[model samples]
Target: MALLEIENLAVEFQTSTGPFRAVDGVSLKVDAGEVLAIVGESGSGKSVSMLAAMGLLPWTAKVTADKMVFDGRNLLGMSASERRKIIGKDMSMIFQEPIASLNPCFTVGFQIEEVLRIHLGLDKAARRKRAIELFEAVGIPNPAERLGHYPHQMSGGQCQRVMIAIAIACNPKLLIADEPTTALDVTIQKQILDLLMRLQTEHRMGLIMITHNMGVVAETADRVIVQYKGRKMEEADVLSLFESPKSDYTRALLAALPENATGDRLPTIGEIFKGAAQ
Candidate 1:
C-alpha cells in the first residue's frame, strides 16, 4: 500500500473576512521509500496542506477530505489525541527554522531525549545514548558534549542537525520537511538536503520535501507536486517536470530559477507567465 494518500483534500481558515481557502481539492499519493517534492511560491499552500494532514493546523482552520490514509490507516477518521500518538512516532515533521522551532531555554540534548522518552519510553541513560547516536548520525561534531548546549550556543547548521536528530528519534516511516533549507547558508542547505536524502534511504521511509527550490527537487525528488494559489498545477516525475512541464505556472517557476537566467536581469514571474500566454 502507499505510505501516504490524500483524495479531495481541502483546508480553509475562518478568517475575519469569512472563509479563506488555503488548499483546494488537492490529491496526492506517496509510496514507501519515496521522495516527493512539493514546490510553489510563497502563499501557495504547499506547506499548509501537509500541516493540515498532520493535524497541526489551528482549531480555526477547517480541513476536509474524502480520504486521507497513511500506511493503511485512515487519518481523517482518527481523533486529535489518536493522531498525536502516531505523529511524532510513526510520522514526524522537520520545520523550516530549526533555531526557532527548538526551545531556547532547554539544552539541545533534553529536547531530543524528550522525543525518545515520550514515544519510545526510553530511560534517561538510554535516551541520552540514543540522542547522541542521532546527533552523530546527522553529522554533528562532538555530539556527546554538544548535547548539553542550548539552541543559541550552536550554529544554524548544528541546530538543524539537532532538529533532524529529534525528528528521526523514533525512526519515523513518513517525514515531512517544510522548507528545511530556507534560511541556511548555501553550503549548509546542500548538506542538510543530502543528510535527509541519506536518512530517507537508510531508513526506507517516505520523505516529503516542501520547497520552492526546483533545483533541490531535481537533486532529491523522485516525483514533484507543483502548487499555485492553493491549487495543484502539476504532478510529474522529476525528469518530466523539468523536461516538459505542462502548466504555465510550472514553466514560470522553472523560468525563475537562477540557474536558468541568461540576461543581466532575471525574468519576473509575471513576465514568464505573460510570455507563455503569447
Candidate 2:
C-alpha cells in the first residue's frame, strides 16, 4: 500500500471575487521510501493540494479530497483532534520559509521538544535530549549551544536545519517539504537536500518535495508530479519526466532554465505562467 495517497483533491478559496479553485482535481501517491516531487509555478496549486490533504488550509478555504489516505486511514474523515495527533507523529510538514515558519520567541530546542512532548509523550528531560540529538543529526554544529538560541539568532541555513530537526523529530512515516530550500544560497540548499535525502533513506520514509527547482527534483525525486494553473500537467518517473516531457508547459519550463546562466540574463519564471508579468 502507498504511504500517502491523494485522490481527486480540490481546494477553493472564497475571496472578494467569488470562489477561486486554488487546487483543481489532483491525484498522487507516494510509496514507502519514495521521493515524489511536485513541480510548478507559484500559483500552480502544488502547495495548496498538499495543504488540503494535511487539513491545514484556512477556514475560508473549502476542500474536497476523495480517499486522502495516510497509512491506509482517510485523512479527510478524521476529526481535527485526531488529525492533530497524526500530523507531528505519523506525518510532518516542513514549510517553504523556515525563518517565517519558526517562532521568534522560542528557543529552537523548545520548539522541537514541544512536538516530541505532544506526539511522543516524552518528558522534559527526554525531549530535551532527543531535540539535541535531532539538531546534531541534521548537521547543526554545536547543537548544545544552538539549541538555546532563538530562531532570529541563527543564519538562514541554520534556521532551515532547525526546521528540519523539528519535522523529523518523531521520525514520521511521511514528510512533506514545501519549497524547503527556496530562500537559501545554492550551497546551503544542496546541503539541506543532502541531509533530507539521507534521513529519508535511513528512516525509509516517504518524502514529498514541493518546489520549482527542477535541478533539485533531478537530484532527489523518484517520481514527478507536474502542476500548472491549479491542474496536473503530467506524472512520471524522474528520468522519464526529464528525458521525454509530454506536456508543453513542462517543456517550456525546461527551456526557460539557464543553459549556462551567463551574464545578466537569468531566466524569468513569469514567462511560464502565460499571464502578463507586472
Candidate 3:
C-alpha cells in the first residue's frame, strides 16, 4: 500500500494582495521504502504541500484536498490532536535550515531528546542513551560529547546531522527532508544525502526528498515529479525523466544542469524556451 496519498490538493494563502494559491491541483503517492523526489524552484510549493500534509502550515494558509491519506488513514479529516501524535511518531520532517530550526537556547542533546520523550515516552536516561545512538547513527563525531553543544557551537553540517537524528528518533515510517543540504559545501551535501539514504533503506521508510537540485534527485530518487508554478510539469521514473523528459520545463531544467553547462554563460530556461519558440 502507498504510505502516503494525495489527490487534487490545493493550498492558498491569505496574502495582502489577495488569496494566492501556492499549490494547485496536485496529486501523488509515496510507497514504503521508496524515495520520491519533488523537484521545483523556490516558491513552487514543493515544501508547502508537504508541510500542509503534516499539518504544519500556519492558520493563514488554507489547505484542502479531495483526498489525503497516510498509512490508510484519512489525513484530510484527522483531528489536530491525533495528527500531532502521528507527526512525531509515524512521520517526521528535517527542515531546510538546520541551525535555524534548532532552538538556540537548548543543547542539541536536549532538542533531540525532546522528540524521544514526547513520542517514544522514553525516560530521561533512556532519552539520553537513544539520543547518543541517534547522534552516532547520523555520523556526528564524538556523539556523546557533542550532544551538549548548542546550535551556535556546531557547524552547518553538524547541525543538520543533529536535525536528522531528531527526525529519525522515533524511527518514523515516513521521512520528509526539505532541502536538507541547503547551505553546506559540496562535500558535506553528498555526505548528508548519503546518510539520509542509508537511514531510509535501513529503516525501510518512505522518503520524500524536496529540493530544486536535480543532481540530488538524479542520484537518490526512485521516482521524480517536476513542478513549476505550483503545478506538476511531469512525473516519471528517474531514469526516464533524465533520459527523455516530456515537458519543456523539465527539459529546460535538465539542459541547464551543471554537468551540461559547457560554455562560459550557463543557458537560462527562458533562453532555451525562446530558442525552441524560434
lDDT of each: 0.92, 0.89, 0.93
RMSD of 1: 1.2
| Model 1, backbone clash pairs (residues 3+ apart or across chains), number | 0
Tens digits of per-residue lDDT for model 3, 1-278: 79999999999999789999999999999999999999988889999999999999997789999999999999978899999999978989999899889999999999989888888889999999999999989999999999899999999999999999999999999999999999999999999999999999999999999999998998999999988889988999999999999988888888888789989989987788667667
Model 1 steric clash pairs: none
Candidate 1 lDDT for residue 186: 97
Between prediction 2 and prediction 3, the one with superior lDDT is 3
Q: Can you write out model 2's per-residue Cα lDDT over 48-150, one digit (the tens) per residue?
A: 8888888898888999877788999988889999999899788999998888999898988889999998888999999888988998899999988998999
Error of 3 at 73 (Å): 0.9
**What tens-digit string does per-residue lDDT give for candidate 1 at 1-278?**
88999998899998789899999999999998999999999999998999988999999889999999998999998998899899999889998788999999999999999889889999999999999899989999998999999999999989998988898899999999989988899999989999999999999999999999888899999999999889998999999999999999999998888888989999988799889889
Q: Could you give me the TM-score of model 3 versus the true structure?
A: 0.97
Q: TM-score per candidate, in order?
A: 0.97, 0.94, 0.97
- Which portions of model 2 miss their true places by more than 4 Å? 260-278
Clashes by residue pair, model 3: none
